[model samples]
Target: MALLNDIDGLQKPDNHYILVLYPGAETYESLKNALAPLISDLIILKKRGFNQIGGYYWSVELYFSSDWKFLAICLGMKSANTLHFCPWCDCSKNEMNTTSKKINKSMDNIKVNYHKINGHTKEPLFHMILLHNWMFDELHILLRITDRLWELMLSDLRRENVNEEIWKEKILLEMKQLKISFQFWYKRNSNNLLHTSLMGPDKLKILRELDLTAIFQSRT
Candidate 1:
């Protein structure tokens, strides 16, 4: 599914437009073909301003936004776990922790170099938009960060020899108190505990209201 939103406009349901809607695997070739018509229209829109019925002209400034995985796929970049993982900059896996780096990548540079440059596996599907104009989904970033924090919390509980069932129950109880639906269960084939996949709002509640000290109090 591809959605187009007017950023400058009010946050309303009508402001969002669905460009493409289909069910299929999201691959480079698939996305390139799926978005071909949209891209073609965007190129023309960017070059020539769209004229309105009442003597008004709207100049389009295109921006592409998606989750990191989809963004990587669209940009024809390697997965985040790869050596040259970042789509925005030349930063490799080792340098990801560094903050003070120059923004050296541009759409022109990426187009010229294509697969030969900074983590790019092929030409970007949305080459009409500038590289800087490509935005990351904020919800995904929050979800991923909270996921890591949840993992670390679980590791800490395990390290302290906390009973799995007890901790799981405690977590579920806490989630219930916070009005967030969460659970822990084991698959038939796997010993690992799998929990409910929380959405952005639920994850935010967990991050803000989850009482870690209470969860660890019995161990201490």
Candidate 2:
């Protein structure tokens, strides 16, 4: 839903804005209608000689939130949620033999099949990548887990075992500490002032190295 500006070999946010705001259920027809003009605009950019390479127009690179069903529709695929079907790589379980190992795929083969198999697609219109917003995903999960844990501690099964005042103090202190920790991590990990340009893949790489779960577990 946002255009990426290439800055120093990095795709960063420049003038970020919402493209659509609709009420009620969103369907494939609705999405295509909303997206058609943007796609046409990219084609116009090509016509204007804005982003040409090797006598061919470079397709626009689009990163979207991790909505598997929606992404499948965007990619002109029937589905993409199963382990058998990955847009990134080819790895699928054998259809004939249930116990057989997965079949690995070559990049060339995947691209050829992917472009050819879509019922509605004549050719790829853009380069799309799934974007799982780690900041929001982790924050939401962490807060929910914290809330549930607090509830369980105060439930009838364990309420009278510990002093309520002391328990509350401990829980509050831990929550405050986590908040401070997360702030520090955010400030350190972010390169842009607005924090809107954090690359999903780069963040995932950093997370693998840092292993924030271990840190959280240590605190608990």
Candidate 3:
């Protein structure tokens, strides 16, 4: 029962957060660096595990608990863990077929309906996507599922006005803002799979001016 903590009056941090659920340790750290700007107002960053005490079911509850602004799931290794029953993923196996394992399993004991879902969902959080390693584990069904989920969530970025330095960093140097960089491939690739080829850790470079300008425009 890891209830939400009221850190800094951010009662339900997910409301104003960019909730990230990652698996591995190192990539988790790197993502932390890239996402420092959105890490405020009691935002949460967790590395979920596959266990009984504080593992899978905990993640399932935390994930489906409430409507969040954005939920980003790092679909690591084709997300083979639950296959059809990723709590992070709302669609079930019977309806989506992508999650049929849930349907095949015994739900009488679990008390979950593997083939059905409630209607009128709040928007899913984050920009779920896959790293380039989609070829590693080699589960074609899971691979396709990950790819679809990635593109489906990315379509909501609202990039129409455009913000170059979308994430932020700042200081004053020799007559200039001594700013650091931010990544935006997560922004670009999020739109469509055809554009996924443009992804790379370095592909998204956002300096301060562009980031601010875009943020400002979104206000109007």
Can you give the TM-score per candidate against the true fold?
0.87, 0.37, 0.18
Off by over 4 Å in 3: 1-26, 42-220
lDDT comparison, 2 vs 3, better candidate = 2
Provide the lDDT at 104 for model 3. 26
| Tens digit per residue, CA lDDT, model 1, 1-220 | 2234545554666766788886878888888888889878888988897899999997777888889889999888888888987777889889978998766788877877876786887888778788888888788888899999888888788778666677777887898899887877789898776778888888898888889877877575
Report the C-alpha lDDT of model 2 over 1-220, residue by residue, as the tens digit.
4444644534345545666566635555666677777767755653564455667655544344435555555555455434444443344533324444343433234335655542323222333232221112344344455545434533532335544445444434543553322111135576321212223443343334433343233333
Query: TM-score of the candidate numbered 3?
Result: 0.18
Question: Which model scores highest in lDDT?
Answer: 1
lDDT of 1 at 135: 82
lDDT of 3 by residue, 112-202 (tens): 3422433212221222212121122224344455556444433433444444333111211211332333223445646422332322222
Clashing pairs in 1: none
Worst 10 residues of 2 by lDDT: 127-136
Please report how far candidate 1 places residue 143 from its true position, in Å.
Answer: 1.5
